[model samples]
Target: MAHVRRDKKKLLTRIRRIAGQVAALERAMETEADCSDVLIQIAATKGAMHALMMEVLAGHLSEHVVAGKTERGRAEEARTIMELLAKYAR
Candidate 1:
């Protein structure tokens, strides 16, 4: 998590932006904005969430999972990673 500390400011900035977007989404719903407009915002929120998850997951796998496993054992981990990636793929 030391690396996270190093990137804390940048991460916080992104999270704050996401929070703002979520608030905007709430506003849009309360105001009964156009259906397409709300859907577009929802899509953007989903993309932002996915990007955040990808960053955290990549860091965790590199720092913890791969670091603890042997080269041979990494193949199984790689396969699992690939499957998860495929599941998330657009």
Candidate 2:
């Protein structure tokens, strides 16, 4: 997430798409759409969120974890990223 401020618009676009997917999922649930269809929508939303996370993670890895000036800063960034990955994998 290192470049979030610089890439605000891009991140917002990704978030907006995820929001639209969530809305669609809600509509599907309200309409009693097929279980499989709802599952598909859910998967799409999850994918969108995962994609956004990956984008931010890449920036953080390059700009902070790998390129940080101090070893302590880099180690901290790496720890943060590992925690995020652990959560995301679940």
Candidate 3:
């Protein structure tokens, strides 16, 4: 989790932005915004979430998988990442 610690500020900033997007989306829904407007908000929120996931995934790959000293450990990490990716893709 050292890499997470190093990038904590950046990650937190992204999380905060995502939260704002979610709030906006909620407000749009509450106000009965136009369908197109609501869709745009939804897309924006989804993109923000994907971006955050990607950033964390990249960090995990670099810090945990690629940096692993043993082949078995790296393989296990890779399998875990693949599982996560499969779930996320769904």
Candidate 4:
């Protein structure tokens, strides 16, 4: 989305951090780290991913749905957002 372009760097940084968390989780598994440690890493990674998703979702709502030029367009985007939330939300 065009709005993403405005915050591309910030989003990339969040993605990179999430990637690092995943790599750490992989390493923990490879080394047979304690289960608690592995679980903690998993939680951290999931939370980071959720936060990133929320940030982008907010942007989409603001820039695409709320700012849509037509009522129909807004309604369509809102429905898509609801579907995504239903599919992905914890």
- Which residue pairs in candidate 3 have backbone atoms (N, alpha carbon, C) closer than 3 angstroms, thus clashing? none
Which digits, one per residue and each the tens of the lDDT, describe model 1 over residues 1-90?
554776778788888889998999999999999999999999999888888778766775776467845776677767777787888786
> Which residue window of length 10 is worst by lDDT in model 1?
60-69
Clashing pairs in 1: none
- Every model's TM-score: 0.71, 0.93, 0.97, 0.97
Full candidate order by lDDT, most accurate first: 4, 3, 2, 1
In terms of lDDT, which candidate is stronger, 3 or 4? Answer: 4
Off by over 4 Å in 2: none
* Candidate order, TM-score descending: 3, 4, 2, 1
lDDT string for model 4 (1-88, tens) is 9879999999999999999999999999999999999999999999999999999999999988999999999999999999999999
Candidate 4: where is the Cα deviation over 4 Å? Answer: none
Q: lDDT of candidate 1 vs native?
A: 0.80
Which candidate number would show the highest lDDT if scored against the true structure?
A: 4
lDDT digits (tens) for residues 1-90 of candidate 3 = 787899999999999999999999999999999999999999999999999999899999998899988999999999999999999999
The 0-to-1 C-alpha lDDT of every candidate, in the order given, reads 0.80, 0.92, 0.94, 0.96
State the lDDT of candidate 2 residue by residue for 8-56, as single tens digits: 9999999999999999999999999999999999999999998998888
Listed per candidate, the RMSD to the true structure in angstroms reads 3.3, 1.2, 0.6, 0.8
Please give the RMSD of candidate 3 to the true structure: 0.6
Who is ahead in lDDT, 1 or 2?
2
